[model samples]
Target chain A: MQGATVATYDFIFNGLGLREWCGESVRSGPMTMADLLARGAAPAEPQTGFDWGALWSLPFPSLDELHKACAEIPRSRDLTRSLEAGFLNVRESLRFVLDPMTQPLSWALENALHVAVNTPWWLMLMALLVVVWLAGRSAALVGLVAAVMGFLLFVDHYVFAMQTLSIIFVCAFLCVVMGVPVGIAMSRSNRFQRLMIPVLDMLQTLPTFVYLIPLIFLFSVTEPKLYGIAIILYAIVPVIRLTDLGIRLVDKEVIEAAEAFGMTRHQKLIRVQIPLALPNIMAGVNQTIMMSLAMVVIASLVSAPGLGVLVLRGIRNLELGVGLMAGLGIVLLAVILDRVTKAALARVNAAASVARH
Target chain B: MMDRQVSIAIRHLYKIFGANPVRALEHVRAGTGKDALMAQHRHVLGLRDINIDMRAGDITVVMGLSGSGKSTLIRHVNRLIEPTAGEILVNGENILEFGETRLRELRRKQMSMVFQHFALLPHRTVLDNIGLARSVRGERRADFERDALHWLARVGLGGQEGQYPHQLSGGMQQRVGIARALTSNAPIMLMDEAFSALDPLIRTDMQDLLLELQTELQKTIIFISHDLDEALKLADHLVILKDGSVVQQGEPQEILLKPNDPYIVDFISDINRARVLRVRSVMDRAPETIPQVAGTVDVDATLESVIALSGGDTALSYAVRNRDTTVGYLNMQSLVRALVPTQAPRHGNRKQEKAQPAASGPAA
Candidate 1:
């Protein structure tokens, strides 16, 4: 069968078989098999030749030679080892620095004290006045504030609203102070961005209850700062992420233009980049404040004083009236904060536009 | 050099990006050079051995396609990206060597830039956006506002100061950008395709505005654009870059008339030569005493304008005069020959896209 196959292959290669077949046909002139093949005749041997020696001896440098070529280079292994060492050192130093004894006395003291100053009840009334002013004209603002204040006064929940307001202020402030720089840093460096983004993603996706778990272990449950810190962490991610995103989103052309004008890196960041990124950052801040409000109520589980506590109190005691009033107060606070920040953002955008002109 | 004379001088700038930057820089310095450096770091050469001198009152347009290092080149002028090996002189002083305070001062006093996307602070009004640089430079709010208004008025955005950028049209936004740059009162302005983002019509209008502003202020502008037309229109001196190196640099007219490289010739292929070339450029000078005709076109007039004048037989034979003397006459034959597309030598004859012939109708 192999000899037949080789013979058929030779016949196809030389075109003798086709020519012989054609010669026997009547009323047809003798034609070469090459011509027949050229005219689309089938081939006998599709696989004609192979070089076994060339295939067996594919040229390659020796392993030692390759090693010599690669030596004295910055090896990936060395890089990996150094990186690991650096990270280990950083972690160790962080642990040492963050040791309980080494921590600032003031921070420890503040953490130890379970007391947080709740805003006076008058502040809630003040907030209502501002909210009224923003949502409506002066008369509407006054009327709304009066109605809310009168309702709270009648219900005797004014003090609880004030307490919620104060805690929200402290938590929101800390969120801003910490979140903005973290956002800026993330915006500035790709490595930092890569490192922080996953952390941020984890923070964002983790259940709000999960935050209390870590805090519960780190500090006493009765500490006021515990809830404050928890609320800040819970709400801070949005601002930080947004700040980074906003700054990154600032038109690259604009940054280039700023640099072309000979603006220093710092000047450009502070003057050009940050200002442009502010709207999104503020939006982030707005979202954070909203989130903080959402968490404030949950934080009431750990004695965070606010309308949250009142609502919790209402739920625990099954006081439908108390819960309803407290919920209403929280809504009022949320609206007030939202409106004010938005108004402030509007004002900022307007001023920036005007200055641009 | 006098204080006001020298604008910027860049000398032998090099930048190498790597984990071991110092080693890469040293290797570059040792003259195994750009190739070796790139080999070592697997880095793309952003700007290689760049040397440029920008003068006061001139618009030097850096024309290059994206990633040609035009942006990187401009960034180096301000020390935004530090050069690996180079010196940049601003007013004869090496600005790259300047400390932070001096650099900031130089930027605050001597330069301003307009971005392509009209980087108006979205959180601020037009007034505040223009006033930001002033505020950053520590100007009083009231003083800055007044100055900003003046700039707004200059850019024809006098009454729109209170509106947010979102409320304005793209053209108006760019005008605000121009105004923002102007508000700083810096002598040097860098515009990186500042009008590139706008629609074509608005871009033209903005270009006209820039020209008008240049006429008034002449602020040693360095504009970057990928569009050759924009570069030709606005630039006194044009630098055409390809592959992180300058392909050619010359006056726009020179580059247009006699392109130094095939790349530039290809770039300028579609330009209406009749429109771009002036009558003075192609016209042969005649004797001063030659008799002149009653109707003569200006030497500065483009061939397109001259062609439009050729309607009937009488209009066909118009005089091309230099000042008062009739230097030459532009007939239909010469005009047609000039208008006929010339094939570039390197790229074989490009068959022009033929206009579909209009079909005749029995009635109008």
Candidate 2:
């Protein structure tokens, strides 16, 4: 690691004369090879190039091969530096737009997380039971939620799990609120749909960890929006897609009949399209919620406090029992949320079918 | 009387379906045929220069086969399909020039359509379905429910208000459709193959009910049908269409008797004339000191009833009465001549068999 840092500075300032070509570097201090290596938290170098103690020493794990590869890489007209500047500029420009849009989400998440951690354990548990019972209208679902939450409490993960739930609830609600109208707009116009589908595809196909990286650069880690934005972007795809599909799949004759009856555009959308699209929309909401929960765990790496933070700590300290208990708590929370939402979806379908009959 | 008070008038209406309708409209105006237009330019000519004056308080039935654009023509009245070029006037006001608000008002308050598939919303109750137009007009449930219930009962669906469309049979659903159309009280009702989807028996019953309702309501009805018999029965004015152009148009009886186009002639060739031709159509001026007949047939009675009353006596003469007044006289000779269809090629043999049935069986 020491040799690599010395070579990097030597190539940049002396061997390449980069100081004369590109001006002095923006770095403030006169960083030495040892200081740079220490700051990077790099691994210690192997004393021997051939470690006969290891099974696969032929596959050298030093930067020698990487240095040779870098030498071969063309630097005649480098684009990487300019590209990085461009990306930063873009991120700066988008801040004005994204900050306002994401503020409500930040507020909801902070307040909910605060309340969840501050409230008494019994109070929060009772509140969760009431909410589950109201949504599902089922005693069994209530009992199941109570049991799962009770176990989390017993394992000393109750507040952490609650914080995760609070984030998920806020993210999922915002996703539905924002996604449904976008979907409706897509359903109304084919051109709009064509424009939006590619963007949605990119969002959904992006790796989950990649979602946090750009967000981390774009917003401060201390700001609630850093993780809030990541969770929303990761989870909003299903709701928008299903909503557009549901509205598009409405029967043509039904639409024609609506038009013939002199229904206005808004009336038709509300009374005919949305009512018929309830089942698909509800399913989308369920998927969005599950995706949000999944993202919440991953989002904790960027300062989000939850059971995921405990899991991260366990991993850092190599504590097997702590990791297992946190993982179990997350699983239980997942089941409770899934069952409650599924029950609500079933009720919606029942009401729709009854209306149809 | 309604002939003088035209309710809806379609003038020079042309509907050409394709990317470039103007180019196709030029071909249609140049007297291009349907097949030629399609083959040459990949355009479908839906209607060509259609001109029909739908009278107030009368049923004008437009009859044609599939792809003849009868449905297209009826829909054009409501501007459901924008015409390639033309004008539709409702009550002397051009509907083609109507803006969105006016168009919506026309659809909501002036014209209500009955679709062949009933078009009842599957998600709504029967009463709600009937009140759709009213509801779209922003009427409250209480304001329109009574009218819906009234029409529901009138269509013999009184006790089934709370039922959904899927729970009803095809015929019953159409009755709900009729109730829906009437509940709006739209003066011009456009029925596009309204009874075509029902069983024959239920269709006949619906036709009878429509005729019964027409007697009192006197709503101007523009009924589109592919059945010649249904057209002849229902239409006060019949328009025959073929390949998107009008082949003939007149009173149903006149069209049946003096079909100008061979296509019109062939279309009515298989019609059972005796069932459709009324006594007033066959009756002559009543002669003074008319002989007391076996029975006085009403002027509105069908020729089949007259044949039954005569008891197959071809020589018998009957007094045709309009209520208590003797309006005209019907002799079996004229009835026989009317029965000998002008379109049939072998007139002698066919007339002989028809006379044989007319001779012995009718009177009971």
Candidate 3:
């Protein structure tokens, strides 16, 4: 049966003129009586060599190789592989340009992680409560954060939670530092705004996993900045978009008033546009924090030390309790960050409302 | 008033609004009408050949219906809106030639504007809003704040300095706007429908306040308004606009007594003539000898006031006096005739609506 199959494939490949293109030695396998009979009967009917008869059985010899009659086209799998190879070819130059520019980010992430882990637990807890209080100024919020941190410490997951938070803090801060000016530039120039929209859309809609592939090639798996870059790329879109919208939404008559008063362009931007856009920028910051926290778990695949690493270990060892505990820790951390940022945003909204009223 | 030197002289100034304003301007200069130019070249004729010599220390009111470009003409004085072609000479220097810095200096030191909508900054305190012009010039806060506070008190908004604009009523907000203009210490005040957004009672109060301020400051003021009543009440020199072109311009009383164009006749036909016409406009110039008169009336007295003095007796005549010296005679017949407006042409409403300016206009 194996010999008969090989002979049939040889006949089809030869009939379609693709025998040499397929790169296979013709009929090298051992032959059986069925193969020998097929070969012997092949030249008996010379006029019927193309098989016009026998419609039900072997009506056409080259049916499997019909498209190969002209030329062999690259398949979908080949197209994807070649694209990756092409990207690899330019990786050296890209790394040369990007490595120096982004070196500081890796240092920042490493040092921030080291600090978060080495700090005394009591001091860290106190500092966390202080930050929450300053942002929210509400007793309820401060108590909530204190309770969640206490629970994490009780469960011995405090270090992992802090690692995740440290990563988020560094990445989200950088996002705001870079995103706001871009948003301002977008708001001020129509041409710049038109150019930036598609880029923002691509960043927003791209699958979360797809970007990680290129990022892995760009930096070492062990470097914290590999995930830092990943988190920043994933989280910067909202702040930029919201800031642009906020500035553009200022009342037209107010701008006219500013111009009528003979305000210089810089003076107007600082005194009028930025202040009015603050509430929106705050909201963007809130969104960026939430997004960065979500990205930290995915970032753990590249050896990021966090609660995500615990979850990955549980999955590998099939330890159900460990996985569940780490997952709960992440959820608690997310709630803590979300509430803190939201409370700050609410305060800004209140101040802005007072101005409007 | 006649001897006062011209503060802002707009000569052959034209503003066409479109992508190709300069090309459209050639058609306008060749006598193509506003509507025709719009239809043929898709350009709006904002102002056409506007020529006015605004005297220092006098209120020059540019009156027009909506779309008549009174606001456009006023903006040219400050170079807020660039003209397609023309020269605006402020104090004998062509302001059109001023570059960005010089133009800003002109707006900061020589011209200040009050808007129809009180465009006070919502985020700023009333005091900061009042000091906007000085603040933009990088003046020390302490230096401008004192002047801002003084004007604040003068405009009747004292002790409201700490409140944001949204915390105040519309009338009060506009008072802040007026004070802000005053704080700039600019010699030329441009009021672009400054009181049109207020209630009728508030509008009247604002008008009175502006006139009171004008009497004290004697600034070269260019006031734009659609209301004929406001124009006649405030204008020392009135320019009536029709379809982006001036139809008649002179003393408000003269424009009322001798309307040079049919459009002006139609415009003034609906006005309360008794309230606007003055005895000086209707009275005969000083004669060699005075005729017998029932009583004397001031040259500036409204014709309605003279009617009350004469008891509606057409046979009675009054001596027109200027500070107790007889200047002319006002017969009751001529006063009565002046009170009766000239009949407007029957088919003028369509043209009136088409000429309505986009900013706003008072009801006829």
Q: Pick the candidate with the highest lDDT.
A: 3
Candidate 3 docking band: acceptable
Chain A TM-score values for every predicted structure, listed in order: 0.63, 0.77, 0.81
lDDT of 3 by residue, A1-357 (tens): 322333323555578777578653333334435446756663433344555563345424342223222224333344677899989999999999988989999999999999999999999999999999999999999999999999999999999999999999999999999999999999999999999999999998898788799989988888888888989998999999999999998776677667777877898899888877888999899899989988888888888889999998899999999999999999999899989999998887765535442
Better of 1 and 3 by DockQ: 3
Displacement of residue A339 (Cα, Å) in model 2 is 3.9
Tell me the DockQ of each model, to 2 decimals: 0.21, 0.27, 0.37
In candidate 1, stretches whose alpha carbon ends up further than 4 angstroms from where it belongs are A1-127, A131-166, A181-223, A256-275, A283-357, B1-42, B48-55, B84-87, B131-134, B141-151, B286-297, B307-364
Q: Model 2 over residues A141-224: C-alpha lDDT tens digits?
A: 999998888888887788899999999988999999999999999999999999999999999999989888778778889988
Alpha-carbon deviation at B308 in model 2, angstroms: 3.1
Higher-lDDT candidate among 2 and 3? 3
Candidate 1 lDDT, A277-317, residue by residue in tens: 88788888889989989998999998777688778888999
- Tell me how candidate 3 scores on lDDT: 0.84
- The top-ranked prediction according to TM-score is 3
Model 1's CAPRI class is: incorrect
Candidate 1 structure quality by residue, lDDT tens digits, B180-212: 889889988878778888899988888999999
Choose 1 or 2, whichever is better by DockQ: 2
